[model samples]
Target: MSAPRFGRITAGPAAPAGGEALSELLAGGGARVVRIASRGQVDPEGAWYDQAEDEFVLLLRGAARLGFADGTERSLAPGDWAVIPAHCRHRVAWTDPAGETLWFAVHLPPA
Candidate 1:
């Protein structure tokens, strides 16, 4: 079998002007990895993420704001990492409008 390719995590083209792009990097055995490119995209009104698996996410570049159901918010800068437990309600409150925000998210031990 061919070996898996390992390369720059910051690869890929820029996200569109005002939309967010998500690409699955890996997935197997109840776990998955995804890369997100955001250009000022925010979670829709009253929408929340109730993921089935725990997620460990890192802000690769740019900045973002994450919001929880408890009404607290977290601002993320490059190199910031967050581990969110499964079932915790959360959302992307905001992202950098002037530039692209890159994210690496890994879902652990699926639901």
Candidate 2:
């Protein structure tokens, strides 16, 4: 057997200017956990993410907005969360420009 791992989710390096950084926390058994740090980054125009797995994301710091292909948007603040279905087209609409926006995300096998 292996020992358990431990660490703080909020502990990490700052994201680069006008960009975002991703850190994989765990992955196995068709699931993955990730930490995302964003610094005023937005998805490119006309671009969308159509992922193969369902994603559950929680905002841990700062603020953000998620845009969908249906022209709807969801605003997220600290402690807010959303579940994105697999293959659902979406994009990062906005993020706080003066501060870091941290997110905790889990990707699960498609159903």
Candidate 3:
């Protein structure tokens, strides 16, 4: 059977890990869509880049910070959204403990 193509609001269980949390809303075909809940317990390790797809992230709940390759940092809170271009090196730097960091991440084919 083929997967249904449409729009909806889907929620799933929390991710199991220490660094990042992810609950996939859709995982099929050429796409792996998910909602990310993160708590930056520590700075990210090493330099990382996404060559296959650009990541689109939206802060759905909680507060956090992001560090980029250019050494620039930004604090994020609920209702904030950003798009990280493909192949960009970046990392999570910090987060608030009062609440669990929740964000939506949609990965798309690279330009």
User: RMSD for each model, in Å, please?
Assistant: 1.3, 0.8, 3.2
lDDT per residue as tens, model 1, 7-56: 67778657887788888888889899999899988888679999888999
Instruction: Give Cα-based local distance difference scores for all models.
Output: 0.91, 0.94, 0.70
Higher-scoring candidate on TM-score, 1 or 2: 2
lDDT of 1: 0.91
> With candidate 3 superimposed using the best TM-score fit, by how many Å does residue 79's alpha carbon deviate from the native?
0.6
Clashing pairs in 1: none
Best by TM-score: 2
- Residue range with the least summed lDDT across 10 consecutive positions in model 3: 8-17
Q: Give me the runs in candidate 3 sitting further than 4 Å from their true place.
A: 1-11, 14-18, 49-51
Clashes of 1: 0
For model 1, state the Cα shift of residue 71 in Å: 0.5
Q: Estimate each model's TM-score.
A: 0.92, 0.96, 0.75
Off by over 4 Å in 2: none
lDDT, candidate 3, 1-111, per-residue tens: 878766543354453344566667776555667877655444656655545778888888778887888888888888898888877777777776545677788888555
Q: After superposition, how far is residue 44 of candidate 2 from its true place, in Å?
A: 1.1
